[model samples]
Target: MDVDIEDILAELNTDSTAVDQSGNPFSDINNNNNASTLYNESSSYPETNLKTNATSTSIPSPQQDYNNLIILWRNERCAPELLPYPHNLMTRMLSRIQEQMERLEIISMDFLGQQHSTTTTDTTGNNPVNNNNMLPLLCMEAELERIKFVIRSFIRCRLSKIDKFSLYLRQINEENESISPLQDFLSKDEMIYYESHSEILLKLFNDTILKHLPPNMQAINDNTGTVPMIDEPDWNKFVFIKVIGPQNKIFNTDPILIKGDNGKWYYEVIIPELQERVELIIDSIYVMRYKVIKDLLMEGKVTLI
Candidate 1:
């Protein structure tokens, strides 16, 4: 069957640059151990660096930024764990957003100039302002606002996580008081915020009530008792995800050879472990534990809803 090239290109809604040589975002993991592969391959992207102090000034295409920001926003919103900071993606997204804003400004200025100079009347001699000229500028402004909203929400989502689990995140990195602390799941700016926020809260607590406690009992992260003082994220939280990459054979595939009552061969196997034992087809939705799918989410094999 002959297919139109334009139709195929039109179907590629996301940025094609995201797909690597194998045409899979994570280079087409073909092993049963897919989760680990997701983690290892994520570092390949210039954007998803694990180093909290790392900086990225490279900008990707606008489409790539838009799609990636949406993915980051949605996953950050739903995931129980704080996903790795997408350094390059955020850098590029903000750059492109600023560029679009400048463009809108230029378009607005031009629209005003045209309105003052090119005033026109219809056959009825009515001299109303031309909304047709404002259409393109209005559309661009709307798009810019939408992108800005997504960026703000994405950052705010991360901030909320940082605020909620500030102690937990600090514990992840700052537990090592001897070494230079680096948040494994936070960006450099976010790390600053975390430190300031945590310090202020601790100081306020101590000034208000903790100062009266005994020195030994004043420890904030007192894990010595039945309940720990430090708050932690719910790693076992359930989330909805849509598969965006290939699945491992263990999922929705048979390993055993069997015979049916009709004497026909059937490959049947049971996996009582996986919460959602289904093949990862593109766009297939499933509900599963956040920790179980966290690696896949980082690898871009799936996105949270």
Candidate 2:
């Protein structure tokens, strides 16, 4: 996984007249005037399909996607409740992943083909390893693995949230058939997973514990009384957020109080005019209750670090 991407890419992008790692000036790969680079990142991309900016139709660079993935992974983990699935971002990223995979397969095949065609050896009496050719493949594979890891972690975080609040989501879904968090926040596959998990959990409870209880107490989601049985995400949970908005933008967040390690509560923000809300400055980090800044998070003004 230790890869130097610049060196490998630079070597592959050299002129046809230049000498290669094996000291062969005219290798089959370099013979053509317009040899295809291993990674034609800009040219290989499909049309831009981003939801972040609907009117902007230019493809974002790989670094932008990488940073967005990191932000999304953190936000999904730190937020108490599940967030909406990013359909457009995911679609573009997945398409690029598939294309990169195909490109790698082709390059790997070419490596084998070119090696077979090379019928020469140096004074060392051993076949050249072609380190220059293989380096890009190794680095690219490592980077691709990293991207897949982040994506898998993001999906797993969402699944955990769904599992933790399965009954709550189901109750809300049943109460309102038109609009619910189940329909708005969850993806189609995740909704199906929630349903399957809820059914299995209910069956397990009925077969083991619930069957022994009285009829009145047998219901799993008994929110009628003061104390509710079903669990829901706590909006009071504190999260670390950083303002990522433009210089001109400012957030007037709801007043939030935090309990310190000594069990003493204090206001993180000083009092201001209108409902005691405080101004959130740009490039500043704050620890506030999730409910207090949920709107800002939803509006893309701040990111959970």
Candidate 3:
């Protein structure tokens, strides 16, 4: 077959003009170019790939949660006057008490001076008839009345303040129950006032209620191997045990053991013979090491006979 090269070139040119002049195919070509550019850009810089890996953490234990709860309670519950009450009632009560105490002290001092003066005057046989009996009794009675008044006033003031504080606390508790979880009624100023009031209340509570409690109730001094005991004469006494040699091992041989209701063991040893009780003050580090050993044994971290 005889090929016509000129004819074939002419046909190709005609097809190209037809494709471009129609506008549809030409626009399709431009759209494909734009689509290609967009695809390339999107693939080159992927949005999902830019994200960091998410990390999962374990939740805290129940004991840790409980401790957090207690801390929050201490922070929030200590100040009752800030939310609702006779405003600055605690401050007023404290000031009144102090003033009354001062007055009582002054009255006591004056009475004491008067008595001393009278006794001295009588010793010198210079007792005036008026000073001997009537004046002293009258003065003493007046001092007594003043003291009684102060005492009664102090008691009444304290009672009133306490009653008001209690009522406010109850209101707060009720408000807490009724309010929405998302709602916060306390303003910035109120929060600041509450914080200061809380600190004052904490100090007062510690000085008054906490101080009067038995020492064992206030703090757990595990450093001093003092195991609380019941049905024993010296229940509060700390027990000590003597280690003879510089050895790391604790043994059962002649080891003084103070056992509690919880089956916890403490060493009991008498020091300075004259001292009535046996008490040992263990270093915190040693106590911690001992605790680790104990925990290891309990948890099967170490095998023992």
Collision count of model 1: 0
Per-residue lDDT, model 1, residue 23, is 20
What C-alpha lDDT does candidate 2 achieve relative to the native structure? 0.62
Scored by lDDT, the top model is 2
What tens-digit string does per-residue lDDT give for candidate 3 at 136-198?
A: 334434543553454355334433334334334334546676652111333234444545665
In model 3, residue pairs whose N, Cα or C atoms come closer than 3 Å (at least 3 residues apart or on different chains), thus clashing, are: 240-268, 240-269
TM-scores, all candidates, are: 0.68, 0.70, 0.19
Cα lDDT tens digits, model 2, 163-197, are 99888777777888786345556667887998898
Counting clashing residue pairs in each candidate, in order, gives 0, 0, 2
**Candidate 1 runs further than 4 Å off:** 1-60, 119-129, 175-184, 246-282
Best-to-worst ranking by lDDT:
2, 1, 3
RMSD per candidate (Å) reads: 10.4, 13.0, 41.8
Q: Where is model 3 more than 4 Å wrong at Cα?
A: 1-84, 123-305
**What TM value does model 1 have?**
0.68
Against the reference, the lDDT scores of all candidates come to 0.57, 0.62, 0.33
> Which residue ranges in model 2 land beyond 4 Å of their true spot?
1-42, 45-63, 117-129, 246-276
